[model samples]
Target: MRIVACLNGDRRPGAHPALPVSADQLAADARAVVAAGATWLHVHPRDSRGGQALEPQVVTPLLAKLRAAVPGVPISVTTGLSAEPDPWRRYDLVQRWGALPDAATVDLAEPGAVEVARLLADRQVALEARLGTVQAARILTASGLADAFAYVLIGPAEPTVAQALETVTAVEAVLDRAGVALPRLLHGREQTAWPLLDTAIAADRDIRIGLEDTLLAPDGQEAEDNAGLVSQALARIAAHA
Candidate 1:
């Protein structure tokens, strides 16, 4: 099971304030996370004004700096539809940057998601199919485009770990039936984060944890930074291991 730390690029004060906003802060956080048992790093490049923008100019420099900071750690970038509404524009950014990370996670719920996945595959970019629901997981698995799989256990309406696990189990079964061999990364969002982490660790599943998923630690206290979150997650995994 691999633990990946996500460094949110967007730095909204009230919204996930623990996320690293600047490139230097992100590099520092990545180094700490790597030392804290995280073998993979997921990044979202922030604009100068602290907004989530995946411009080639922004991402290229950010990737270069992160690579220099955390050598050999597999890096994944988010192709979040919520980051940008227009699929064409987002596709343009993906094309222009030619800045491929180790992998890219594409949300299955997004518009034109399958098309985007096809494009990513055509470009030889590995894909992490993001499944937030049973339907979405079915759609992704059915499409047969994912090189890897991840389930986002959070939604606007809070769902229980059992519910999320049910979805994951079903998706796993579906993928098995489809003969797909993609590795899975399971995670939760907001207040349900630790519970889901517990679920994944108990099930011996790979996972991702960081400020992007939850600003609060398992103790119900706010995390000071991304490294702190990674440390807490590592502690949990260690105890389970």
Candidate 2:
């Protein structure tokens, strides 16, 4: 199982204060996470003014910088359709940025998911299909659009380890029926982060963690930065490995 780091672009510190918004900070974080045993990196580029908006002009340069920093790491960017109502407009950025990352994650819960998937496929960008439930997985499988699959397990207001494991089992069953032969990355949000990592490690699925997913380390303390979070996750994986 591989651990991927999610570099959430939100800098204001909603859930994770360690998430880096500046390009220089992101580049530095990328290096640290790579050193910490993360073979993959997922990023959401903030606007030039330092806000969460997937503007190609903003993202393209950041992607270039990240590529320079971590040459071999497979990087994936977020095309958050839920951030915008119109799917076509959301996709326009992907079309505009001719420079493609290794993969792009598309949320199946969003509107025009099929269309977005088609656009991604047309551009030859590998897809990391994301879902929060079995229904969403079925939708993506039926549409025949996803190149890879992931289940985003949203933690409860106060999450528990058992709850995290249950969610993964449910999603795994759903995918088994769907018969999708794609690499799977499993993760959880908020309080469920560490527990989900445990579950993912047990399941032998690709696991991800970073400031974007949770600010606190597994020990239930605020992470100093993305590097700290990655280091902690790497230690856990090594113990299990």
Candidate 3:
């Protein structure tokens, strides 16, 4: 199972004081996480005010810096609608990006997911479909683009561990039934983060950790940084093996 370290998401400034915001900060964190044993990296490139921004001006430099810091590591960026509500604008930004991610996530729950997936494929960027529910899985299956993706990111935003696991199972069943045999990257947010990480470890699924998922570590202490969270996760994975 490939362990991915999500350095940052659409987190606002001050959400976590140690959260990486600038290109330099993100690149440093990327290097730290990889050294801590993460083989994959997911990040939401940010703007001057630290909010998620999909514009090439914001994304290119951040991606360039990350590639420089972590050569050969697969990097992914979010194409989440929250960053750009207008589908045309989002598509345009991605098309114009000077530097591209090795892989990019297209949230199936979002509008224009199919178009985004096609654009990524055309650009030779591997696509990871972000399925948050059975409905999203069905949408991907219906689009007949299952083979266009490299992995299915089962990201359940459910607040409780039970709810999150249940959702992941349901989405998995849907994909299975549709013969979408892509490897899955399972993760959860906020309170469900560590519990789902434990689940992923037991299941040997592609998993992720960092300030993007939670500010607290598995023991419920404030995580020192992305590297610290990743180190703890790698230790748990090693013990499981």
Candidate 4:
């Protein structure tokens, strides 16, 4: 099982005081997380104005800095529609990705998911299919693309521990019924975050954590930064081990 660090999310700056917004800050955080034993990175690039931007120019520089800071670590970017609602515009940005991240996550529940998956395949980029619902998992499985992308078994942003566990079980059941088998990463957000991560560890699955997922540590204390989150996550993984 590997640990992925999600540096910054599509969330606004005020969402977390430690969320990295600038390119330099993102690179710095990348270094910190990598040093803390993160196997991969998931980042949401922001423009100079501090808004999520999918433009190639905006994405390339930031990714370049991260790549330089943490050489050889796989980096994934978000292609979710929350930042750019227009599917065509999102496609265009992906097409124009001058410096591509090693992988990108596409929510299967979103419109144009299959198209984005195909585009990623065409470019030889790794795809992580976000499974938000059972229906979404079924859609990905039936698309004949399940074998090509990794699965992200995501739960509710702030569900109870029981709800999060049930969500994971349901997703696993769907995948089993679909006769699908692929690498899977499990993650949840807010209150469900650490609990679900523990679940993932027990299940022997890859897991992710960072400011995008939670602003607090397992002890209910606010995280100081992305490194702090990674350090705490590593500690959890070790405890489970």
Candidate 5:
């Protein structure tokens, strides 16, 4: 099970003081995670004010810095509609991305998921299909895109550990029925993060962690930074291994 380091999400500066907002900060975090055993990297580029931005001008520089910092690590960026509401505009932004990422995520629950998947596939970027519900899994399966996309099964952040496990089981059953044999990356946010990782480790699924998922460590203390989070996750995975 590989560890995908989500360098940052659409998280604001107030989300975590150590959250990487600028390209330089992100690049440094990327290096630290890679050194600590992260097999993949995911990031959400930000504008000057730290808001999520999908335009080429904002994304390219951040991606370039990350690539330079982490050398051959597979880097990906999110194409979530929450970052840009207009579906057509989201498509256009991805099409014009200056420095292409190794892969990009297309939330199956999003509005223009099919079109965005086609666009990314055409550009030769691997697709990481983010499936939140059984319905999302069925939708992607019916779209004839399952064979080409990896899957992300993220449990909700709010639920109790038992509820979260149930959610993961339901999604996994849906994907299994759909015959989704592609790579599966499982994760959760906020309070569910560590428990979900524990579940993923036992299930032998690829897992992701970083400030994007939670601000706290497994011991319930705040993480010093992304590197600390990655380190703790790696140790947990090692214990399981």
Candidate 6:
């Protein structure tokens, strides 16, 4: 029942109505989503100019405020390529984090993913392995670093639902063959979000949903906010559970 509420992704504030950008805004939404039954939070801290960042200056204050806003729930941030593309710079940024999120995603699709992941492991920050493609999963398998992560998240990059599901199954099967038994967290982006969520539900795996996954509800209507999406996900989890 790990309902992760992703407040905002790499997208700017203008991408969605009231998308949380500032520290204050993200803190407010964190409290709101927790109240709405979200057990975990996945956040994107923004810089002064409103772009996602992993710089110590940008991430420190945000983590401080979030810890105050929602005291107990686990908070995670992205180490995805979108935040900072340069692998070495990304490594430097994460290495110097003034305050660290409880956990952080290390997407294997990006360059130097293994190196970055090893750094986070050395720092004792809990890891979430983001496998958005078959190649990423293979990389994880080849690296033999499955035990370092909190879980492996399958977020398919395929455009169609069938293709996405197929890739998810393939990735899982590959990991299974590699003796990687970490719990799986399944999600999809935009058009594939709801269907993949259902797939995760029926399979009884951990599921993530929020603006990062989609801007609309299951009925194809625009969602009010992260809380609304969490509420919807909770309802569906109940029904499927």
Which run of 10 residues does model 1 get worst, by summed lDDT? 148-157
Candidate 1 residue lDDT tens string, 9-78: 3347457665687788788888988987788888777778877777888888888889999998888887
Compared with the true structure, what per-residue lDDT tens digits does model 3 show for residues 1-241? 8799998888887888799989999999989999989999999988998888999999888888999999999999999988888988999899898788999999988888899999999999999999998889999999988988999999998899999999999999998888888888889998998888889889878999989899998888899999999999988888888
Of 3 and 5, the candidate ranking higher by TM-score: 3
Clashes of 5: 0
Residue 69 of model 3, lDDT score: 99
Off by over 4 Å in 1: 9-17, 146-157
**Tens digits of per-residue lDDT for model 2 on 36-64?**
77888888777656676666778778888
Please provide, for model 6 over 54-169, each residue's C-alpha lDDT reduced to its tens digit, 9 standing for 90 to 100: 99999999999999999989999999879997889999999999788899998998998999899889888899999988899999988868788888889997889999999999
Q: Which digits, one per residue and each the tens of the lDDT, describe model 5 over residues 84-162? A: 8899999999999868989898988888989999988888898898877767777877999877775554645445777
Query: TM-score, each model?
Result: 0.89, 0.88, 0.98, 0.96, 0.96, 0.98
RMSD (CA, angstroms), candidate 4: 1.3
Candidate 2 overall lDDT versus native: 0.73
The positional error of residue 55 in candidate 3, measured at the CA in angstroms, is 1.1
lDDT measured at residue 111 in model 3 versus the true structure, 0 to 100: 84
What candidate 3 gets wrong by more than 4 Å, as runs, is none
Off by over 4 Å in 4: none
Backbone steric clashes in candidate 3, count: 0
- lDDT, model 1, position 218: 86
